[model samples]
Structures are given as structure tokens and as C-alpha cells.
Target: MKRIVPLLFLLVAAASLPAEKTAWAFRTGINLTPGLVYNRVWDPGYNGSALTVMSLRQNGGFILGGGIEAGYNYTGFNLHFPLRAGLTVAGGDSLTLSANLDLMPGLILGIPASYFLFALEASMEAVWQVSPCLGISLSAGPRYTVSPGYGEAVSPLEFIDLTVGLAAVMGN
Candidate 1:
């Protein structure tokens, strides 16, 4: 009777414990970024040039956390360090969706020159959990950057970036 009573108590205790929720995850991936440059600009008007810059990118992020990206620029290299915040918009056993914003400060290095870059980005992400520790993610975002132009003054550039990622999730 004592053994049965103790077993029952253990079962009750286990049942009373709250299930853990996923509050954190880490993602890493490769991204392709193609940016369009403006040749002339007026207030609320822009004459976009056909010039485009393509970059090969490597990125990492922490959920509700921070982000870092390194890119091989067409001429040299660039680094973006961003502060990020996000929330899960929806979720179930196998999938989740999120929206995130990032404030980034970075450096662009070119041959014999360098420039400071600042940007704001808004992104939407969808993740499919394949296992407890592995997930695949697709993210798309628009980024606006303020940086020095090639020959003129500081200018703003716009980009649409797409990323395919893999993540490790915990506390789910």
C-alpha cells in the first residue's frame, strides 16, 4: 500500500508540472542579396539606375536576440551587426511563423575605400520543425540602407533579401 501510494504521488507530481514552451532558437543560413542603386533622387521620387550589386551572404540569428551577417561584396566585403526583436505570430506542433525587425549598423569595405552603413529591416519568417532539434526556415525582408554613394553624397539604397535557413530550437 505504501509503494502504491508513493507511485501515485509521483504520477500526480509529474502531471502537475507545466510543459516547457519554446522561447529561444538559433538560426544560421546563406542568403543572396541583390541591391538596386539610384542614379538621381528628388523628394519622394527616384530615378533608379540599372546598376545592381550582388552579394553572397552568411548570416546567423538568435530568436528575440541579435543578428550578424558577413557578405562577400562584388568589390570587397561587408559586415552587418544588428539588434533584433521578434515574436511568434502563430505556431503548432510542426510549424511556426514570426515577424521581426532589425536595426543594423555595419561597414562596407571596398578596394582602397570603406563606408559606414546603417539600415532598418522588416522581415517575415516561416519555420517548419522537422525534428526536436532541427528546423528549416524561409525568410523574406525589405531593407533600407543609408550609406555613402560612389561619387555623390550619402544616399539611401533599398533591397529585398531572401534567405533559406536551418535552426536549432530549444525549450519546446
Candidate 2:
């Protein structure tokens, strides 16, 4: 199941790419993500906090891309690799707007052995392309986490996150 999820996301992104013009670009950004955390079975003691991430992406006409992200919060740190896909939903030259979808798989560190977690996130982003080489974006989404419980059962946690970021873009 762990391998299947990422493979499925990659296949979907790749299958959609050939119909587009194939303009390629790369982006690096810093984001501030604030979220509300919840658990279905028990209390986690804390509800939420702000997280900071550094992300890098390589895209093709904003249609599809892959990225790596690393971040930290009050609880610990995490690393993610995600695949993105979407379209230019609105706007014009020198300033365009795009809507995007991302699927991320990640790991969390700094917790006890039984607390080792795996996270899968899905997000929607609104990007304002300021120029051919710059953009600003805001995104919101949900993240689901699964981990081993004290006695080896599965523990599940969920989060709703909102993020704002500024990026430097390169390529066509």
C-alpha cells in the first residue's frame, strides 16, 4: 500500500502531460503553514501550530511537477516528496492565475519509536504568476497521518492546513 499510493499519483500525472505544450520550469519557495490537528480516537493534547517549509518544484507549463519539501513545527520536523498537477484557471500575460493539486507522501521525525508516522497530504493551490520567473501562492488542504500505537495497532490523525508562499521560478 505504501508503494502503491505514490506510483498511482505519478501515473496519473504522467498520463495527463502529453496533451500540453510542455513548457518547463523550476521553483523554490518558503511557506508558512498553519493548521488544526485532530484525532479520531483520542486527544493529542495540542490542537495546532504554525509550520515552516522550504519547497522545490520542477514543473511543465504548470501542468505537472514533482517536489521536495522539508519543514518544522513545535512538535518536530518532517520531509515530503510530492507530485503536482493542474491548469491555468484564469488571468493574462505578466500576471496569470493557476489552480493546482498536490499529492504528498512524507515521514515525521523526532518522536518515539511507537510514534513514527507516515503522512499523505492533498492540497489545492491558487498561484499568482507575477512574471515568468516569480510567483506567489496560497494553498489549503488536508493531511492524514498513520502511525503505530503502543500495542501495535494503527493510530490515525488528521490536519487541515492553510499555506502562503513566495517562489522564484526558472525555465520556460
Candidate 3:
């Protein structure tokens, strides 16, 4: 009962947010990166993070959404839930360029232990509208992950992730 009440309230509130286009788009992508991941010690490794963003368009230049990403950071697996906002920079019939930011509060689970993770990512993309229902994008971003300690173990604050990836956007 305790869990259900807050969940219901959240659903109602999300449904009430204002949208201009009245149509929603879902963005899905993948990030392939060679960087550093640390738990007890830092190592050079490759981390691939899958991403999705569902955007609700507002009347002006902005759109809002939220989505989750679950992936492997070489040493461990993690889940990232990110809130997204996009701004249309230049738009036309075929091509559009936009800037976006994702604020993520994430959870890491696997190898060494589990800890809390947070990352702020900013990216820019050029989206080519293949059809009214489909588009493809290429994007890159730098993510700074906050590593707060769990239990008595103190985690370092030096998890910087750089990623470049391709995305597919599908909608009406």
C-alpha cells in the first residue's frame, strides 16, 4: 500500500505535463567507450552503455522525458535512470540539429560491490528524418560520475566517461 500510493501519484503527475506536439518520440541508442572504471582500484577498460529517451514536445523549442539505461562498464553492471531535455537548434524538412542533457541517478551492481552513481551528460546531435516516423542520430558526450561511498568503503570521485554513439528515434 505504501509503494502503490506514491507510484500512482507519480503516474498521474507525469500524465499531466504539458506537450505541444501531442505526439511522443522514443529515442534509443548505444554507447561504446574505452575508459576507466574503478571500485577498489582504477583500470583501463571499455564500457558500453545502452540508452533510451522518451521525449514529450513542448510548444517552443524544448522537449522533456525520462528513461533508463542498463549496461556493463567492463568490471560491473549498472542501471541509469535519466531525465532528459532537448532543444532544437536548427530545424528543417530533412535535417535537424539539437542539444540535449541527461541527469542520471544510477545504481551499480556486480563485481566488487554495489554503490550509488550519478552522472550529468550533455550531448549534441544531428538528426536526419528518414521518414515522418523514423530518424537516425549520431551523438557524443562527456559524463562525470559521482562515486559516493557505500558502507565503510570510500569510493573515489574520479569516474569520467566519454562516449560516442548512434541513436534511432521513432515516432509519428
Name the weakest run of 10 consecutive residues (lDDT summed) in model 1.
Answer: 49-58
**Candidate 1, clashing residue pairs?**
none
Candidate 2, residues 1-172: lDDT per residue as tens digits?
3664575456445533554455655666665555544445433333333333323332444566666566764446665555666666565665555666666655555434424445555555555666666666565555555444422543344544455555655554
TM-score of 1: 0.60
Off by over 4 Å in 2: 1-20, 40-62, 110-131, 138-156
Q: How do the residues 60-156 of candidate 1 rate in per-residue lDDT, one tens digit apiece?
A: 2224445456665442466665556666787788987888777766666555556666667787878788888667777667666556553344334
lDDT values, one for every candidate: 0.51, 0.53, 0.67
* Candidate 2: 10-residue stretch with minimal lDDT: 49-58
The full ranking of all candidates by TM-score, starting with the best, is 3, 2, 1
Q: Model 3: which residue pairs collide?
A: none
Tell me which of candidates 1 and 3 scores higher on lDDT: 3
lDDT of 3: 0.67
> Candidate 3 residues 1-172, lDDT tens each?
3443454344334533765556566778876665556443667666566655544343456756666677776436776777767788988988988888877776676446567767888888788999999989887777777656542365354566676768888876
The whole-model C-alpha lDDT of candidate 1 against the native structure comes to 0.51
TM-score of each: 0.60, 0.61, 0.76
